[model samples]
Target: MTWFLISIAALIGGYFIYGTFVEKVFGINEKLATPAHAQNDGVDYVPMSTPKVYLVQLLNIAGVGPIFGPIMGALYGPAALLWIVIGCVFAGAVHDYFSGMLSVRNNGASVPTITGRYLGNGAKHFMNIFAIILLLLVGVVFVSAPAGMLTNLANEQGGLEISKTTMVVAIFAYYIIATIVPVDKIIGRFYPLFGALLIFMSVGLITAVGFSSEHTIMGGYAISDMFTNLNPNDMPLWPALFITIACGAISGFHATQSPLMARCMKNEKNGRFVFYGAMIGEGVIAIIWCTLALSFFGSVDALSDAVHNGGPGNVVYSSSFGLLGTFGGILAFLGVVILPITSGDTAFRSSRLILAEYFNMEQKSLNKRLLMAVPLFVIGAILTQVDFGIIWRYFGFANQSTATIMLWTAAAYLLRHNKLHWICTVPAVFMTTVCIAFIMNNATLGFGLPMTISTTIGIVSALAITAYVVKVSKGKGDTELADEEKPKSAPETV
Candidate 1:
């Protein structure tokens, strides 16, 4: 339990120390008008309270990723905890903060639009298609999983029964409403309640584990064991663990979620509490699930066996039900169900916003909103019919790749203003290498090169990219004074 407590404290401390420093580095100006107020459309860019934005952003980024990802990461033994702490503080939270605050500075432009300003049109265009495809994948997969679970639950109950198709239609209906409605109408009012359920689920499970008489969940974590990959299947921790635990540690998907909340934020200063703090909140949930998986089944080997047999979904269901009784089980199940559904709605919403921003179209009209939203759902419905197993594997790489690019974007933002750019530059380099080596060494993705060759190539690629970014960024320093107070016009360029 010591390591678990330590991980929890580290995540909390990250918000105060590192989070505050990042906020200062970017320089928040409360006196400046935000997008929500400057361009209040009531549909998407409406001002909202800091607390409400925090909860909505939290649910927006967190799908079932944190829960299921870490449980699978737990198969690597104590290594998962170390990554969750270090990666959350240094990489994930920092990426999220910039993704949101940068949007705020640029008048709530979408990620691709902002990427264009810093990285160039090529990146912007690539990210435009990249983000849309990833979001569509997320929306479709989330719908099918929950629909299947709900179908089973409904059928099992004594007198009632439901088909997967019926559940699918019902879920799709909610997604459309959530996607098309005003920010205040559906998301603002209902997300807080969903967020409450999520918090309760995490808190209750941790409480149960803390008071349990089972072997200390954290006792297995030793310094010697920290670097070792104890994955029963022998998957390398270098890339596999990093990719497996993306959401809890550092995920590109969260960066996409950030701009959604950036449009609603009332103050620039709230970026720390809403974006950075929310990532830490996800880290805590991840740590809890990692700890439970490592101990609840007696050993990491046992957890691996369970995972191989039925996947992480089964592990989550069985662990929650076993640890907490029937009532708690139901809540745990709902929490799992609610997670993907909440994120699914926002995935569609973000896609709509991205399309609107890309085409320079006004979104205040219902027809305009539908014009952007309908095609996305039509595509999503079609995707739900196809087998997504292989496609799903690519999301991890795409997510980390997007995050690597975002980190460089943040570093470029700092460099252009003559502030410290090393903060993002370092993690961006690290993740860039990870992404390179991962696909190269894996047979299914790349050429399945030898480990030594892949690692060497990854390092060379990182150095080349770092050199290019620094060279281009020099002599582009905008006056920090005016830049911070008024900021640059990002959306206008689009």
Candidate 2:
């Protein structure tokens, strides 16, 4: 109970303490006309209220990552809590903040363009392909989770005869509609309901955990937790926990999602709450799941067994059903289902935006929007046929690797300004090590080296990345404003 309360306090405090420091460092100008006003595309660059954009960003970045990632991470016992708190405040939230604000500064450009601006033309081309591929993978992965869940719920609960294949097609259809429509038409119209369910689900589960006497909250933390590695599976903390935790701590996926909201921000001041605050909100949700995984079953062993038998989806259903009763639990389950659906739609929408920018296609024409979207959906539908397990194996690594690049991008952005660059540089170096070590040590990916060898190589790689970042920083920057680098009448992508 003590650690849980303290952890909650720490997350909220991070918003005020470290979040304030980050905001000041970015130097938000409230009076600056944001793209929503400056560009006024009526599609992607539509002006949204601060609170509205904050909620959109929250639902956009969250998906199942915050819920599923942390539940899996909880398999590591109390060690997971350390990563969520520390990672969110310093690394994840910082990564999100810069991704958003930098977009706002640079005419709401996509990640490939922004990274290319800092990292150079080679990176732009790589990220152009890389970012779109990642989004396609996300769209496909998201489709399977919800469609399967909905099929089961409909058959067992709704008493309606339904098929997973039908649900998949239906979901894809909705994705096409959501991707093509203006932001305000569908997303803006339904988010209030979505937000209510999100609030209900997150708040209900946390309250249940707080009151349940079956296990103490401190059960999730321990004094020896600092020195002991308690993973029952013998997975090391170096890279396994980092990957398992995934976006609960940090993810490159959020870098792709941030620009979606950045284009719609009504004021520069809202960047802190919309981007940084949204990540904090996710950290709190991650904390709740970790604590539930730790305390609900009364021990890490029981929780590990549940995860083994049924996976994180089972943990979510079982815990919600036990704590919140059947009716409330169904709504909670629906909320979990909704999280990914929202993100899945936006993933394609983001891809369309990225492609529009890449080819200089105007989004105002319905024909141009469909021209890009048709091919993207074709690629996504084809990917749905691939073995999901194989695709998922790469998702986590791709997510973290993209995050590593974005952090370095942030570092380069600050370096060009001659501002304090280490805030991002430090995390960039650390994640470079994690990504390198994981790929090197894992049998399925790289050389399958011994941990000792992999860790050494990872550390050496970090030093090299640091030296290169400094070199990139010292190089010349473009002479014009970011907006000037872009077309004056350029509208945002959908």
State which candidate has the highest lDDT.
1
Q: Estimate each model's TM-score.
A: 0.95, 0.95
What does candidate 1's lDDT look like per residue over 93-195, in tens digits?
Answer: 9999999999988889889987887877988999999899888888987898778767755664324667788999999999999999998898899989999
Candidate 1 overall lDDT versus native: 0.86
Model 1: residues with Cα > 4 Å off, grouped in runs: 156-160, 214-216, 219-223, 479-484, 487-494
Residue 84 in model 2: lDDT: 92
C-alpha displacement of 355 in model 1, angstroms? Answer: 1.1
lDDT of 2: 0.84
Model 2, stretches more than 4 Å misplaced? 213-215, 218-221, 475-494
